[model samples]
Target: MKFSAERATLLKALAHIQSVAEKRNTIPILANVLIHAADGQLSLKATDMEIEVVEVIPATIKREGATTAPAAVLYEIVRKLPDNVLVELDQADGDTPLQLRADRYATRLNVLSVDDFPSMGAGELPCRFKLNAGVLRSLIDRTRFAISTEETRYYLNGIFFHAADADGVPLLRAVATDGHRLARVETDLPEGAAEMPGVIIPRKTVAELRKLIDEAPEEIEVALSETRVQFTAGSIMLTSKLIDGTFPEYDRVIPRNNNRILRVGKKDFSDAVARVAAISQERSRPVKLTLEPGLLTLSASSPEQGVAKEELDDNRISYDAESLEIGFQARYLNDITDQVEKEVEFAFSDSAAPTIVRDVDSPSALYVLMPMRV
Candidate 1:
């Protein structure tokens, strides 16, 4: 294959493709990216058996051919090349090493058989829709922090996406949980997604997709089947195998009658929690919340680090519920609060029951946190 592409353009495409290739692989071809040059464009493809990413960039084609080259090595070479320099790639045949040249620098990368690369095809995607990039970003950013990292539960390792009805209006929802905390966010359902089946997108796929969409166009195309999902953003296309498992009915865990309400500024609450939790040396970093009609106290204690406490009065907090004390991991509380805007609302039933939290300005997103012993 022979082609010449601008360094900036080629480097951007390689950065997206090379990340899909696994750093360690048993198969030789799986560690390489398939490079094809034809019809005034260069297509780069890389996969790790489960997720595949392909990106096409405009290039000056000298010959119509294809070959495989080490993805990481090629990416590094292009990245180091001077900006605005034109990168040239050439290979006589599949048996010959690929030559890369840019200005005064030149290198040869060992080639692999392009026929050996596996393809994870998006088979018969029946459900197709379009979503605004900003909306999609909101759904992922608010919920992904709660995705489970536990391997045994496999089913809980990704965000659950499906169509549901809120009152009489249909909405698309993303829910994630790790048994201790849960995040649920929803947006208005788009056209052609009413009959879509619920799917669990793997954690890795969610992360990769999020990165690509950061600078994507205003609108993103989405197509999915029961077993696979595909996202198309401009010149980049990603196909991933969905996790085949049933997500638990998450609604049962959300608190319904936690009538004791507390409204506080997000900055004040987060800052107070951070200060008190800094004194703890435990892995969980437990912080206690002592609440009264018009005051809230945050405290933490450790055998080696001693005790720390901070208080917020009625001026910064509005609470009229009976006095209550509850404990929670400082890290988990921070994760949920990071998504909130100006103010945070907390509903409590007792010291031991699950607590409901929400952003006072964003009604479409909700969170649930389980209390711990202080």
Candidate 2:
């Protein structure tokens, strides 16, 4: 393959592609990126079996050919090259090393057989839709923090995406949970997405997708099947295999009739929780909340570190519920509250039952936290 591409453009594309390639792989080809040059464009592709990313950029093509080279090495070389300098890549055949040249720097990267690079064939994607980049970012940012890191319950290790009806209105929803806490966010369903099947987008895919969309254009094209999903953002295309497992019926865990409503300033509550939690040395980092008419008290205790407490009065909080004390992991509380802006509403059932939380400003998003015994 032979092509010349601008250093800045090539480096940006390589940054996205190399992240998908595994640094250490039993199959050597899996650690390399497939570089194809043809038709006035250069296509770079990398995959780690479960996820694949491809980026195309305008390049001066001298010959139409393809080869595989170390993805990390290529990215580093181009990234360190002088800015705005044109980068030239050339290879005579699959057996020869790929030559990389800039203004004054040159290096040869060992090439692998392009035929050995695996492709994650996107079978038939029946459901397709277009979502605004801002909306997609909102969906991921609000819920991904709750995605499970536990390996045994693979089903809970991703965000569950599906179409649902909220009061006869079709809505696209994203839900994630790690057993201790759950986050659910929804938006108006996009066109052509009403019949899409429920799918669990793996954590890694969500993370990579989030990074790409940060610089993506205003709109993103999404296509999905029962087993796979693909996202297209301008010249970058990402295809990932859906986690083959059934997510639990999450609605059953959401408390509906909590009735005891407590509203507090987001900053005040978060800061108090952080301060009190600093005293607890356990992994759970338990923080206890004591609630009463017009007042809320936050406290945490450790046998070795002593105890800490903070109080928010009616001025900063509004609570008319009868006396109630609830225990929760401080980190989990912060994670849910971080998504809220201005004020946070807490609906409590009892100290023993799950507590419902929401952003007073956004009705489309809801959270449930399982109380930790303090």
TM value for model 2: 0.99
**Tens-digit lDDT track for model 1 on 34-57?**
999999899999999899999999
What are the RMSDs of all candidates, in order? 0.7, 0.8
In candidate 2, what are the lDDT values of residues 221-314, reduced to their tens digit? 9999999999999999999999999999999999878999999999999999999998866768789999999999999999898999999999
Evaluate all candidate structures by whole-model CA lDDT and list the values in order.
0.94, 0.94
Model 1 CA deviation exceeding 4 Å by range? none
Pairing residues by index, what is the TM-score of model 1?
A: 0.99
Per-prediction count of colliding residue pairs?
0, 0
Q: TM-score, each model?
A: 0.99, 0.99
- The C-alpha stretches of model 2 lying farther than 4 A from their native spots are none
